[model samples]
Target: MRTQSHLRIGDQPWVKWSLITLALTLVFLLLLVPLIAIFVQAFSGGVSSYWQNLTDRYTLHAIGLTLFVAALTVPINLVFGVFLAWLVTRFEFPGRKLLITLIDIPFAVSPVVAGLLYLLLYGANGWIGSRLMDQDVQLMFAWPGILMVTVFVTCPFVARELIPLMQQQGREEEEAGVTLGASGWQLFRRVTLPNIQWALLYGVVLTNARAVGEFGAVSVVSGNIRGETNTLPLHVELLYQDYNTVGAFTSASLLAGIALLTLFVKSFVEWRQARQRAALSEDEA
Candidate 1:
């Protein structure tokens, strides 16, 4: 029995260390190595070349457009996400499940398919496109189209994050606030928003990351017009096609930097959430 117990204890550490080592190796190979390679390639031609690559007229414009699209996409989705979460979780309604499934359609569809769908709907010869074209409106190959696709792709992030949380929280506190004569907006602001703010922020972070990193859908609509419609991802492809390897990697590095920053923010949010849950558990105990 003593020998068996000792063997079991020894086996436990071996298994634990083996798993830990495997996880670290995968992380280093899949994430850290690629990240390090990007920076190394970006700086291969020296700091001046790296700076010039980033500051090139087309590259700068691509970066600016990427930021612009993310700015518009994140806020619109945030508003829509909050309202959708509130509606679905706070009230019982017909077609609520259908509405949720529709919200998730973007996730189910490929980004390329999403771009194609928009093109068919808003292309020059498309259904509404013909009517809009009479007014000289260009939607398919313009910034508006890019913004639309980004919003479409990212709309579900915040809602997904909040729905489960709001459901678990229930409407009891909201009911209490309402009974106290709090207005609908006041109840949301004073009670609901406070409870869900962290989750909302987490969702927004995710939405922003997807919006900025989005390539396929944006690529199809953007028409790849350099210095105008090209986003950072598209610009990276353009540079590579033009045989500017260092430039391509430099552009890619900027994107990787944004991703790293998002990951950091996500980690922070998760840490805060864990702390909040611990506190709540202690209070209940």
Candidate 2:
């Protein structure tokens, strides 16, 4: 006989306002304030000083090396991710689940541990490393080592992003295309690619971000040889340790800019994906 209940958790006016206020405060303190502080410290010495710090030879080298690592990491992971996702989702093979689980190893393992493992296996003293050294090859404490660790750390992003999307998108259309005499490449290029383009782009953006910002693993392997092997994050740490506060912040600002740009692209990709879903829903109706 009682009227239907309309109350919900946090529906009270004061509770709602208080929660909103708390979230805004936390965001300001944790995120916005730090970003603002970075810019402020970066330009504290004036624009000319900031520009000079950024244009220093080491800084430029760090920027170039970071970009180079990301450039190589993205394409390698992209192809591997697509192939892995396609294999697991499209085929019923033995050990598929185990393979998927293994893909998450990077996420579960510490970056420092990963770097150390690579160093042990590929450094000059370990079994493989000793053999490589016999052949006059070196990987640890160099750019190659940096590239290897960065790749290891970022390899799972694209695959993780694509697996769920491809799973939801069943292979019916692909099978239909095959029945219609479509070649494998034709089905993938015409059907699979279009369906997962947004997810793929989103994954690429994430991979690029991580590749650029990685510090722990890269540090363990890079040897921090200033202009030779130092990346932007390592450069920032070196500057701060050497008491070059302004220079440190200047290097940091570049990383902040990259992060902001990545965020913007990620949001845009998400919006496009949502709109695509809406359009698809309308068509089905």
Candidate 3:
């Protein structure tokens, strides 16, 4: 009996078109519509109104606070992630697997729960907070607490990106560098950094996106104090609560703009990574 060769599922034209149509419909309804609506409503009162809302003192403060959090969050996580990734991928020790598992705690735990955990540990009545408070230091209900939760939530991104790539690349190149008398810093800067830079940048982009847009944990820890502890996301909520539709959407549009910028950067990094892979393939060939 004869059989068809090169057969594949969903090869029919009708099935292909149906899938495409369904995906586009979902995209339009779920993503595009909301994104468009944000801009539409933001400028509904005209450009001057939108600009006024954006330049409002509270709005400006929120924007500044959000950027401050992201700026701090990215670098701290970047260093920590690189260190953790290197330790796990390059060494064998007790609790190595457990350490790797613990890296995922941020992802596994709910953001709100994570915020509460911080609050419990660092609130005025709590063990650590009671001592810190004696010295007139406060963490919870302030910027420090916001930064802590943001860092906790975004910590996994860079390491997650690097770990698999590092494992696959292995220590051969690094070992060779060491044998040739390269120092640890030199070896990482020259050998490992070049190979994993794209993944590192991709991870940074994701971390920044999450850090900038973080709301739930930040809201809980920040005390939602307008023009002070409030970040952009919290400010948007405040605007909406105050029945300032234009202001709310204006703040939201800035966030949406940030998300778009992140998507663009992520796509660029992926494209660059793809090109690098192709070049390496050609060299091998």
Candidate 4:
């Protein structure tokens, strides 16, 4: 029995690992069940019919418009997220707390309300909308208006990702650069940019995902015009309404595929960044 106990101890496989495996298995089942169902439906239309339906003019137009909007909105959000993160992190201000709270408002606000707020601010009969209309500026229910609402709802992502890191690092590196006679641009380009680039990229990926998949807010402001303001998510809704469940699920599956691709890309990027940081640290030592 003592020899048997010793053998068991020596060859112990592991228990925690089993728990982890079980956890992952459960998670995968939870996600994969619905996804596999959708995939089954998407292809059940047969490869030819699936391709033909997916390539239909309206479907093509919807995909193109959504991609165009995401392309436009993602970059804007990236820049804004980075700049806002830098300002809030690097500077001290009286209303800094208030500013941070305000940035988080979008995260908590119901997306529909966010949509309505934009409408009220930019609609023809609304306050700011009325003034802008008077000045011959158009907004509400326009493409530009749709993108604006998307940005507002997705604004907090990058800033939230960055602030804690900045707080932890403080201003030591940047201050050191300044003390070494580094110019403002040099300090930012050399010191700041390198530090936060990963978080920025990750935020961009997430923000792009959010913007592309956005429904409630975009639905309200977009007017859901086909071949015009109809983004992919809205298009899915339109197809679903027409009793085109296959088409709708096809589009949803496409979005899900994009989301999965983005996540893998983000993970790869973060992995590379981590490896590079590790290499640099090793070299410095």
Best by the TM-score measure: 2
The candidate that wins on lDDT is 3
Please give me the total number of clashing residue pairs in predicted model 1: 0
lDDT of 3 by residue, 1-285 (tens): 424565466776788899999999999999999999999999999999999999999999999999999999999999999999999999999999999999999999999999999998899988899999999998998899999999999999999999998997789999999999999899999999999999999999999999999998998889888888999999999999999999999999999999999999999999998887788678668
Better of 3 and 4 by lDDT: 3
Q: Provide TM-scores for the models.
A: 0.94, 0.96, 0.95, 0.85
Per-model tally of clashing residue pairs: 0, 0, 0, 0
Measured with C-alpha atoms, the lDDT of residue 187 in candidate 4 is: 92
Please report, in order, the local distance difference test score of every candidate based on alpha carbons: 0.93, 0.93, 0.95, 0.84
Any runs in candidate 1 off by more than 4 Å, and if so which? Answer: 1-19
Candidate 3 positional error at 266, Å: 0.2
Winner on TM-score (3 vs 4): 3
Using TM-score, rank the candidates from best to worst.
2, 3, 1, 4
lDDT of 4 by residue, 46-137 (tens): 88867877898888988887788888888887778778878888899999888888888999999999999999888998989999999998
Cα misplacement distance, residue 206 of candidate 2 (Å): 0.2
Per residue, candidate 1 scores C-alpha lDDT tens digits across 1-285 of 456556654377778899889999999999899999999999999999999998999999999999999999999999999999999998889999999889898899999999998998899889998899999999988899999999999999999999988997889989999999999889989999988988999999999999999998998899988888999999999999999999999999999999999999999998887787687678768
All candidates: CA RMSD in angstroms? 2.0, 1.8, 2.0, 4.0
